[model samples]
Target: MSTEILEQEIALLRQENASLKQQIAASIAELNTTIAKLEQEISEHKQTEVVLKASQAELLAIFNAIQDVILILDFEGRYLKIAPSSAPSLYKPPVELLGKTMHEVLPAAFADYFLDGVHKVLKTRQIEKLEYSLPVGDREIWFEATVAPMSENTVVCVARDISDRQQIEAQLRHQTKDLEQTLQELKRTQAQMLQAEKMSSLGQLVAGVAHEINNPVNFIHGNLSHLEAHIQDLLHIIHLYPQQSLETEISDLDAEIDLEYIKDDLPKILSSMKVGTQRIRQIVLSLRNFSRMDEADFKAVDIHEGIDSTLMILQYRLKEKSERPAIQVVKNYGTLPLIECYPGQLNQVFMNILANAIDVLEQRIESKDAPLPTITISTSLVAEGWVKIAIADNGGGMPEDVQKKVFNPFFTTKPVGKGTGMGMSISYQIVTEKHRGKLECCSIVGEGTEFVIEIPIQQ
Candidate 1:
């Protein structure tokens, strides 16, 4: 019994051992194939990692080459990275900036706003723009900054400065203003020259006529007393004729006297001679006033004298009565310090303004039934260094549009042959440029017009 059991056990063991050997060989083959596949996959993964690292290095190089200032902040708003393109001189390498809070590395004044902008982008995950200024050293730099969000609580900020453009714009504005002022001054000078030319021509004409007329006027004036004396002697001789003619020889006195008409006409002839003499005297006086030879020199002069002389020259015009206007002249002179100026030029200014005032008054009165026309002149010492002269007229005032162009050269509101349109403009130049003073005008439509001139007092 033992032998049979042993033989069966041995055969079973042999069969099981052979089967186990085949299973072990198959398992070993499967394990080897699986390990080879895993090793290949590991090698491929390592190659892909190397390629990715190479691409990242290339990207970093490109980023560093740019000139713009770039900063990278960590999750907590600390400076984690910086590129050379941004803040080349202001910051060092990214390693230096690493692990430092933005505020700590940079001053609080500069970093506060920068960090705030960066955090805002990080929190909102959106691009934020800011424009501000900072003092780089001594000069101010204006910057425009763009903050953008990166991966997971990281932000990138870029900044650029644009101060030169602003400065150029400011200079352009100043040049424009200066050009406009220069143009205005040129116009004023031209107007003044034109006025001076006209006045000089008129003065020459008046002087020539005055000189020519003076001879006849003097001859008539010289003989007037003799004519009166001759009339008295004739009257006396006639009175004695009644007593002496009947007895003594009547030597043709009646024939010499033209007794029929002379008795009545002689008195009228004498009266006419007196009236003519007076008229000639008035004309001579007018000529003198027109010339204004007394105050023609440049010196410290009372403006009132110019005004008075101008008024006297224009007395005939003032006396003229029109159905429309009864022009009245008024002088409201105040104690004024004398001003250094050319008296003849100032007198021309007064004459031009006064004449214009009269014309405007006439127009106003003709247009409607308004108040009586009045031209008023006033003067006063405005301050220690200033003297104010005002000429106001109750005349047809200028409109806004017309007033704007009133000072423009060749602008005229009067009819042709009546005005040259350079009067007020010349006055302005004389008072402002030549005299170193200011001249301004105020007017309201249908109300009145007033011109004010301010000049410095003479030393």
Candidate 2:
């Protein structure tokens, strides 16, 4: 029984050994599988890390190379990173802006808006663009700023200074205004030429018509003397038998009973007809003289006559009591030689200058309480074959600054609808360029202004 129990114990020990060996083998197999799985996971993780590193390097390079002023800000509007290109030349390096609130670093005035924009971008993740001028150091600089959300709690702002472009834009605007002014001046000049041409044509037509009319008018006047003599003889014969022969002659004529009255009124009718015909002749002569259609060259002309004719043309302005400043004209005539010029053009110059003088004189009278404003026109032959015409007026004179700009195109001191500044410019071009004359102004602040026109007669 002892031997049998020993054998059974040995068998039990053998089974236990086999079971322990199987458990060891199973454990080893499980360990090997776990090691292979871990190695595969490690390889995948290393590949992902390499890809992430390369993306990070590329992103850093891109951020640094941007030309715009790029900055990273926290949700609270604090600066986290500033691109190197964003720093101004005079400013410290971009690192100095890091880890500081925008409000704490920038000035209070500029900080508020910048911080507001940054926070907005952070909250909405939406891009915002703004343009404003910022004071950098002492001077102001214009910037076009753009803010964009980079992450859930961060913002990236980019700014570009566009002050130079703005200055160029302003310059362009000024040049455009100047060009427009030049174009308007050109138009006015063209119109004035057309008007002068039309007037010349009309003057010639009127002069020819007046001359033809004068011949017929003279014919009627020439017949008047013969008609008067015939009528006088007839009347004297009728008077030979006035009261008694009047009834007898009426019976002899069978129907004419008013021979006495006919004899009485016949002389008056002939005399009136002669006077009327003579008056018609005189009007035709005056029209011929005024138009001067036959002559347009450098001819001998009485300067005072030209002055009087122009004054006559503007007489309506003088006579109308309702016109402003009720102007008073004082003429100071002098003996002057005939100026060698186109009488019509010279007449135009005289008319334009005189009109301007009257206008300015009226304006002065309306503006201030000056006693009886006067425009004194004086003409004299100066030395060196020249003629000096001076038109002086006791009116409001132009200021120095305004005087400087008077010759400029489209510069008018008169309000809109009252005057176009083109009058004097056109007149200037006419006298100085067309006629080769000199026009100069002499003025005092409160006294008045005088315009002196000097032109060589013999040239």
Candidate 3:
């Protein structure tokens, strides 16, 4: 029995030992799992720390790279912080401007503008914008500022330099103005060319007419003297014969023919014919002079001759028309040397101005019971080898606004189709661009208008 009990105790102890061994193994395995999880958690924590550090570095780099001057200000316009990149744009160094109030660092006007924007943004909780200019060093600097509320009592301000943009805008505006002026000049030139062509055709026609009339008029005028002498001789011969000696047939014929009346009227008729021929000759000469078709090139021409020719061309207009009385032209002639110029073009200028003056006078007469219209033309030699011709009219004058644009092409106060509006503009071009001269208009409303033309004596 003792031997059997020993065997069972031994078996039980072995069983207990086996169970404890199993429990120790399980505890060891659990401890190993816990250790591995803790190691994994440590590695993940380190990686997260590295990623956070890199993100912080990248954010700082972005802040430093910004070009705009970023600032934080309190409600009272005191600077709380300044961007690290603001050193170059600030009026002073960052060290000096960092904590200073805007009023302390900037001009009163500029500071007030910024403060106003800040107040507006803080009050409304909305972004506010401002544009201003300030003088820095030797140049003017322009800035556009944006202010937004960052908190209840703080605002973020961003300012950018816009001086270059302003300069570019100004340059563009200047170029646009120049382009407009160029376009207007081109149009004026085209109009002038067209007018010149028309005048050339008219001048050719006048020259041809004058040439054709000259020869026949000369022949008729030359024969009138001979014809008158021949008739006088025949009448003398007939008078020498006695009336009683004359045959009855001759006396009867004389009674039928009325010889006495013929003798009296024949002399008067011849005299009248001579006068008419002289007038025709003068008119032909005036027409030829006015046409100036033969004098196309620049030549030394008598200025008075040009003036007379222009007057003759416009004589019909100067005459008393049914609508108005005759326009009186008072010539204050001056002693002028022969000027070297294009005679035809110069005559055209004279015609335009004189025609305009005549039109003004005629319009005045139709409007009211005005005085007898008068045009006064004065010529004088000025300094610098220049000759001045002043044409003045005693008619209602243009207003200041009209006077200002009187020489602009296509600008007219006359009724359409009545005035081409290119007359004065062409005259201006002729005097200034073609001849290198000056033309000016002086007038007072209700008083009179005067056009002063100055040109050099020699080309």
Per-residue lDDT for 243 in model 3? 58
Tens-digit per-residue lDDT, 1-459, candidate 3: 699999999999999999999999999999999999989998998899999999988877877787677889998898888876543566666677767898998899889978888888999999988888877677788888888899999999888888899999999999999999999999788768656545643564365445545555776677677667657756755875775656775676567666786678667767766776776777778777866879877888888898887887677668787888899999998999998888887887887788778878988845565778899999999987889999999889999999999999777788865666777887888889888899999988887899999999998
TM-score against truth, every candidate: 0.47, 0.42, 0.52
From the highest TM-score down, the ranking of the candidates is 3, 1, 2
Residue ranges of candidate 3 with Cα displaced over 4 Å: 1-193, 196-246, 366-369
Distance (Å) between predicted and true CA of 347, model 3? Answer: 0.8
Q: Residue-wise lDDT of candidate 1 within 19-128, one digit each (tens)?
A: 99999999999999999999999999999999989988887777666556677777666876666634543444566677898677666877887777877887788899
Backbone clashes counted, model 3:
0
Error of 2 at 37 (Å): 84
Tens digits of per-residue lDDT for model 2, 50-78: 99999988887886666557778887667
- Candidate 3 local accuracy as lDDT? 0.81
Which of candidates 2 and 3 reaches a greater lDDT? 3
Model 2 TM-score, all chains together? 0.42
